[model samples]
Target chain A: MQSKSNNSLIKVRQLTKRFDKLIAVNDISFEVFKGELFGFLGPNGAGKTTTINMLTGLARPDSGSIEISGLDCSKNPKLAQHLIGIVPDESNLYPELTGYDNLCFCASLYGMRKHEREERARDLLEKFGLSDAANRKFAGYSKGMKRKLTIAAGIIHRPEILFLDEPTTGIDVASARQIRQLIANLHDSGTTIFLTTHYIEEAERLCQRIGFIVQGKIVRIDTVISLLQPIQKKHTMVISVLHPDEGLHHKLISEFPEYSIELVSKGQFRIVSEKVINIGPLVRCIEETGGEVSEARRIRPSLEEVFVNITGIELNAMKKEKQKNGRSS
Target chain B: MKRWIAFWNILLKDMRAYYLKPPNISWGLIFPVAWTGMFFIKSGKGLDSIISLLPGVVAISILFGTTSMLAVTVTFEKKNKSFDRLLLAPIPLRLLMLAKTSGAILFGSINAFIPIIIASFLADISHVNWFALVLAAIMIAIASTFLGLFIAVSVSEVFEAQTFSNFFRFPMIFLCGLFFPITSLPIFLRPLSYVLPLTYGVDILRGAIDKGNIMPLWLDFLIILGFCVLLFAISLKNIHKRWIM
Candidate 1:
């Protein structure tokens, strides 16, 4: 019998992290493949950031093992760190230094030569569209500018793996889009990206595989397609008719038994079907029932719907739960 | 070589930040100069005695300036969490402590000369041995820098460091014979003054100034060197355990 595991670039086994009686990460085990865009999805206090901290050598795990690029993190932290680049949740940039200087400092910490560090700093600044603000001190930079520079700094050394915590939390739409594009570009260039974000849309767009963490445990991990499968199987279809047909709703349900239909008004009906492919059958049934099928289209469930279904609560509700837990304990 | 470069970077950064705001420099020099000036005005009996006392007084002022300034600055940095950046860096803890201590020492050495120059203009201290004064100033720098490192690592807050530094500074100023002769103190108190590191430092300076070798030069040097080594070891150990985390 062969072991069922692929070549893992980053493997975490039974990792546990606790903060003085509060268990932040509870024996979580996972593997990240080479050149894969993995999304670490969870509401706040789900141990995503704590796991990242342990992986990056900023904090020590209470037990278990973390191996990056086949090197054990506990045995050789510097070497493991060299293989990973991290953009922490908080902006850890040096406020006294300029945007260019912060990047150079990071490069130096990684033992890059002065001239090479300078060139890479300049290149990253231009790539992040921060060249114009390169000379400005970070203390004065806007939030978006600061976040962009931080991302540039993290990738300055071109580490094999990258960890981004909430890469686009409070930015304008255009800047968030640009950041998303940058991440996608990096992923294309063969960098394994591990990202944590509350933005479900970002995970839906970028992640090849995502893990859903709830209360310090990974509740689920799968491809975005698989996680949305249950929701996708049932789509809401809104239909409009030109004339009022009293028996149209009854006729439509009897004719298309696969679809569950509800009449909102004299000329409108709400249809929920088990498959998107059944939308055609439902439209034909509405027309056959002496009603004009106007604006009949399948509306698939969104990431929000999937999240709510899996977690059994909205994002705000989860946050309130976390806050209450924080206050009480 | 890498250690030296890291140390130089830290030292230069501190110097740049210190000079960026000139008030620190002005305040550091003002107190010592004012004290020297008052002593000159009060002591009209002998020009030679006043001249001989000038270097010791200046050395004492510099020692106080460097140690107290470093303690305050380090405590503030620690409290504000700015020191975490340096502590988390790849540089060794000892090198960081040495670099910060040396920066303050360098400033103290420079500020020590201001009072001597001012005194030279007011009193004819041309007869005093300038070579001895330089040596005494160098010793003062080493001793005070270590003392500052000890205080910086041991204390957790600026106000606490300041209060403790002031308590020690006042006694050293009077009892170490910065302004008056150690012989003027009572016999019981005189022995206590001898145990202080600043006492031998002041003796060396005064000996260098007056051309009167009262204590054995090598003995004084050895005692001061021993104090510096002890303070440095304690400071490095404490900083390594606390700051490295």
Candidate 2:
């Protein structure tokens, strides 16, 4: 039998890390295939950044191993780093340096010759749409401009694997759209991307495989279709009603014990169940409670719903925590 | 060849960011020259007194200028998060530190050079052994640069790094026999002077320029070289252990 890691470009086994007494990453194991865009979705303080740090050689794992392109990362991270590019969440490029200079400087750190570094720097500036601002100091760039410059800097060396942490957590809609398109373009060119994001829709759109991490451990990993498939039985029904009474939710729950009913508003209700719920019966129950059903339809399961199901925590709760942590830390 | 290229890239970037600025370039020259002028006025046209002060003045310039520049570089990067890029690079950490040290040496040596030239024309320290002076100046530059690296890696913030730089540098000026001869120091204080790198540095500089022998010239040279190696190793170890992650 062949080993499971045979075709994987990155293989991690029982990886763990600690800061003082706190265990930041705990025995996590996963594999990322070559040229695959894998999304590591998690809330704040869920060990996502810590795991990335260990994998990128910014920090060492206290236990286990990581292999990248058949290179043992734990033993020879310098060699491993040569094959990877990392875009940390913050724009950490030199503020005093011009956009062109930052890209050139990053290329030079990878030991690129002067002529090639400048050439590539100019190319990246044009590609990222920063050519007009190429000579302006990075300190003067807007947040979106800084983000583009940072991503350009990371890829200056043209590594095979790229790691991006929260590439678009907070930015204007247009700029965010631009960044997503750029990421997709990079992936199309055969670069394996490992991205972490709080935006479930972003992950569902970009990732070929998605991993849900919670409390420092990966709860589940699967393709987008596979993740949604297992939760198909958990269906939701949004019904438009007339004169919806407050007691209608209690009546529906009492009559249909297996179903969960919630009044979204006076004239709207959301009904959920683990099995295919019969809206025919729900309509009768609504009428008995003196409400007229206007519209009823099943709502498809979103990645957010799947994430909420897998992590056993509300998605909004995680977003609030992410914002708080972003502020304090 | 690749490592050298990487090193030069880092060196070039740092020079453009910190050492290449006009204010900084002038600061290195003005500081030592100003101190030398003060000593010249106090000595009242006695060429020997001013000349003796020249060696100590030049040595102190290299010490303060190099150490402060490096400390500022490291702490500023830490504050602004650019240090993360350096730590994440594929090159060995030692090479990065070496590149930073080399830049500091170049800046510091130029700082020492200005005073030597000014003193050569403005004040006469007769019978100067040009060879000994050149060698000693080079050694002082190397040693002071490494000392800068040592202080830089010990702190995490800009204000703290500068505070610590002064905390250590202020004492060295008086205790390293820069302003006073080592023999003039109390017997108990002589041991303290011997422990400081600047003591041997000043000994070499003063020995060469004054044409007076405190110890053998080669002994001073050996000691200065040893300090360079020791301080360089410590700085490299500190940066690797703390900053790499």
Cα lDDT listed for each candidate: 0.76, 0.85
Residue pairs clashing, model 1: none
Q: Please, what are the lDDT tens digits per residue for candidate 1 over residues B43-120? A: 776555567567566876777778888888788767655465455444555666777788788888777788777776
Q: What lDDT is reached at residue A149 by model 1? A: 87
- Report chain A TM-scores, every model: 0.79, 0.88
- What tens-digit string does per-residue lDDT give for candidate 1 at A72-103? 87534545665778876656676767898878
Model 1 CA deviation exceeding 4 Å by range:
A1-9, A75-84, A223-226, A236-313, A318-329, B1-7, B18-21, B38-89, B96-102, B120-245
- Models 1 onward score TM values of 0.72, 0.92
- Chain B TM-scores, listed for every candidate in order, come to 0.91, 0.93
Worst 10 residues of 2 chain B by lDDT: B236-245
lDDT value, residue A211 of candidate 2: 91
Candidate DockQ values, in order, are: 0.15, 0.72
